[model samples]
Target: MSAMVDTPAPAPHPVPRRTDGSSVPIGALVPLTRPGWVEAGRHLLAGIESGVRDVNDSGGILGRPVELVVRDTAADPRRAAAAVEELAALGVAAVAGEYHSVVARAAAARADALGLPFLCSSAVLDALTDRPTDWVARLAPAQSHGWRIYGEFLLGAGHRRIAVAAQQSVYWASGTRVLREHLAAHGGTVVEFDMDALTPSAVCDALVDHGATALLLLTGLPEPAVSIVRSVRGDRRLDGVMMGAPAGQPEFGTWAALLGEDGAGIPFLRYLPERLGPLGARVGTALRERLGEAPSFVAFEGYDTVAALADLLGTGEVGRERIAASWAGVAVEGTRGPIRFSRVPGIGVRQWAWPPVQVVDRDPAAPGRFRVLRTG
Candidate 1:
């Protein structure tokens, strides 16, 4: 019998890997060209890119690096929805990043319908999270929580009568309603004004006439917030009145630069805590190096969103259901602090329940020195 030549064992096929060793594809939807949100979009993109770098540097998730696919939504709801569809078509494992609440709303709906996980980076409108979806979560605090914190700060500072200058929009309306309700329940009064209709001088006159000890600017636009600040500061009558702008927190430095000395002593609801941990410091430094400016709250949110997604994807399961289940119980240390999510009744179902937010006073002596006055 001829000795059968044993066939050499077939060589095992090498496991496939991406050129960069990345296995997960994530989409980032940002407003890169919109008039009001362009600068903010750049900042958020920087943070998200930095987060992706950090994740890869740390050996990546499950040994597979993450690839970021960027899409510009331009803060338009239709464009945002289209972007979501495009990302889905690209086969991205998840979608993240949106600066405008309107854009986020549209993007969230599309992502939900496609069964893609979406992590909202900075949109604060409370209604964004009103319905609990298996795939939607937010890293930023809701506007309701932000307004409640603002109310507490104003009331705590002994301001009985507050004047609010707000634009007519769903975002502003929701925030004002929360602020008004909170203040009214706490023996404080709110005098509202149409931000567009009233000139700076007229707003000051109304505040003076109403005997308002504080001014809460909720215009939801940085340019208007800066304009109001300038107007209020120009008039000596409103000099002693405390000024707070919950809408302008992300652009505090810009307002400070425009207001010069006037920006000092003004407080805003800062989503990022004044204090930073070791990881936070590293991310902040990286952001400053990349953006040539101090990181804003939105930047932190963007970074935290990517970090959370990395955590969720690292579990070796990549899909809407798997990510949702993993994310619902995720508690990772973020740039601000411990990041966690829970069902927020009357708000979003599963949202970042406890974002470490603070009321920061801008200091002219130190342009980026965020002095924490109150924390929540």
Candidate 2:
């Protein structure tokens, strides 16, 4: 007597393909991050590698095998530039990946010097675009694009006096500026507060004295946002008004908990939904399967960069110049949406605008988990 058990077949791996029905190894460059960031970077790379394997197995880019080259920037600006140089020295047709904007700017500059096209996965600081580095392209849209959605959400909710909390980081500063400018255009006055400007006590006083009914937090790291909320809560001024965008790691539930009732009415902005849209879902699933976790918009950006390079390689010319030429109109289905680069360099060509304003919903099932109440 035998018990029959069905074993599932393994999923097909991605392969990079060349135009002539041959396989070529596509390479990538990853940044060195601190412990936490490194782990996240690994997740992003794993997803891209998985997609590469899948692409290879399914008849790859034009028909070449995809290969990944990893380097650690150690989260240091100088080291990041060196990493890019190393990747460039390897003669990788194009390079992709880097989460931090400062790191990206350095690496992008290096890639430009070497005549290599740089495609960054995260790096949303507007300064990344202002210089117009011909070597760069980005997967994620600028915070301005997403923050406008946050401002609109607040205005739509009947809030006119809004206070803005910005971080010292490049992305935070630029985004805060854009948010303030736009809010003014919409008849809302913004009282700006730099996270570095005030202590917890001073921030609490400012939030109350400023007469702001709505709070806009623009920063990459969650620490500042958490601190601001705590200050507001401790002062007994938390009247359930808070809003923010990707405070770095992409998880806001814990931050929401710290603020408690203050977080109840708080809504964090997200350009990409975790469940993902039709186009993003496929990329997300494939990425999760590879990374053993869900992919962030950052990781999706990495995938798109490689996809763009892969398309360029499919032209049958494998030099850096040919890659650059092909890059002009390069477009691919990214985890976020369709990605394309403008010839102007730093400005991302096509960005999907689906900034979902998720209000903190206390889940009964999880007890402390925050769920999304409204998304638009």
Candidate 3:
């Protein structure tokens, strides 16, 4: 009976390779549970996963696989800081991926304190990278740049009286401030409306009363933006009015689907064009397969973040200091275009100096499709 006890060799326990001597671990700090931003987080996560896969397929960094450690921040600044600290404790070589600008600020501070390389994926607040830290860099263009481009578009559209439906978030506040200041400089009258405090109908009424020729819907949440658009569409007084939003959910196909006919003729700033070059097209195709829609700007930034990390960590021990040093002059082709960072004053100190951006509107005839109106 004892001889018949042929217990198969205990299946080997798959030990977690904290460091494989070949595998590089990167942390993705995204807002997976944020009330209105979960979809954005999912798309960003998908892009990150796709980027890692591509890196490994092309003979991973230093001939080792890339591993991703994802953490949710719930779109909270404090939670974002905690997530970064935990990722650092887990010995992640670097950290990337944040959608909320406020959360990105907290995470960047923690990453700097931990001496870990943190490449911000999509947070656009100007303060996120205002000062150059050896440990922190950004892949997304600053909000100021995008706002300036938006201001130009509005001016070109002959929108002299603009009303802003702004959310109460720091990102929206700062973005609207820049936009307002820019428009004022150009002799355009600007007025702000609290999106949360007023109903969509009330906001539209106020816009009409104020003789606002354009309505800038800066609510970062898609639902509120859609409601406001619908309200405006119902009001004949707003006919022929130029309505637009900043680079938020309006760039997502899901938002267009929700808006349906209401989305037509509304313009938004988009970082990536619908059509991409070779590298961008490859990432776009993968994203479409995973997300069932074209990749949004956040998704493109996520993929670029991981690709940049792989380039910085190529064939070496993952050290934060080394990664920071190597990142200073490195340039890689990104989903949007060639990605590069530089020390620029007024904007982020070590941010993507110039990322491609464009203003796009939903195609009137083609549902869920966008047409590029202007490029930056």
Candidate 4:
């Protein structure tokens, strides 16, 4: 994060508007480049595309075909905001899909200002808007809701002195706060180590010095997180300490691909049930074929975002008003379960209230198999 500087705005790019009445275009904001998690974006898009295919196959929504107008945010807030502006000008029925919490926050603010209905797919920051508005709704569980569950899991595991290796970001900071507050209330303590300021070995040394029984990696992937995990795992002094990633980093295949056996036994939160329902099983199979792998919970969020919208627009006019009204009026069977939005306290948008919450890890005996430890 650099200091803000005043600079002249660049000339606006001309956006081509929809000139034909062939299909209903919906805006998709995804991260397809660096700094954004491209793997997650691929899965999310696969699910949304799969949902769109299902919608069209079953005789399109309101008999009108659905079109996805995609713009890559690359995890940049400014880029996401610009995409929303362009989508609004293009006359999209609604805007949806975002994986980064900060980027989703920026897009949410822009959609609120432009009065475009937004169905957020994956980003789960609790307060998405500065104020409440009917223009925005979310499909994922709020950060506070999920992270508090993670805190409880840690306490149940008897980790009283927990340490976190963190970086500066609104999403990470919020998760840290949730853990700190929830754990403190239960006679547990949280120790903070700034990953940006210390090397991996230094973090391990500090964990030993502080007598922390557990260390949570609240940082980003592939660099500091991987390095820190390796350092701590190899340190003989910290052999008995547990490692965790409450943000669900290890839920993805890349974690096992990179860390192999070392990635096992580190618990993380995931929004999935113990067993998939009928719809979940069917969609999960389609998503696996579409993505060439198993789908993550983020992918299911994407599918549900579009599927719920299709349910709302049944045999009715497709416009901003109906989409906005879907916040309270629509009830659809999501891949996870029944999907509906309502007012949840402290969340500045319509929310699903919750998706399933689970604390899971890769099985130590079988690194590819995920073992569920607890569910909320």
TM-score winner: 4
- TM-score, per-candidate, Cα-based: 0.89, 0.77, 0.91, 0.93
- Which stretches of candidate 3 lie above 4 Å from their native place? 1-22, 315-318
Worst 10 residues of 1 by lDDT: 1-10
lDDT (Cα, tens digit) per residue for candidate 4, span 250-358:
9899999999999999999989889999999999999988888889988888899899877765636445654575678878888888988899988889999888989
Judging by lDDT, tell me the better candidate of 3 and 4. Answer: 4
- Under the 3 Å rule for N, CA and C atoms, how many clashes does model 3 have? 1
Error of 2 at 63 (Å): 3.5
Please say which candidate is ahead in TM-score: 2 or 4. Answer: 4
Pairs that collide, model 4: none
Instruction: Show the lowest summed lDDT stretch of 10 residues, model 2.
Output: 1-10
Model 2, 1-376: lDDT tens digits are 0110122222222232345654454445555456325654675576567657656776766545666777776656677777767766665656777766777767766666566676676666655633444446666556666566666766787877887776676656666677678778888887877767766567667877888877666643446666665666666566555544434333433443455554544455444554667757777787777765555555665666666666656666555554565555655665555656554333532222322334333443553455664454
Better TM-score candidate (1, 4): 4
Model 2 residue runs over 4 Å out of place are 1-32, 35-40, 129-134, 219-222, 246-265, 273-279, 289-293, 343-376
On the 0 to 100 scale, the lDDT of residue 163 in model 3 is 91
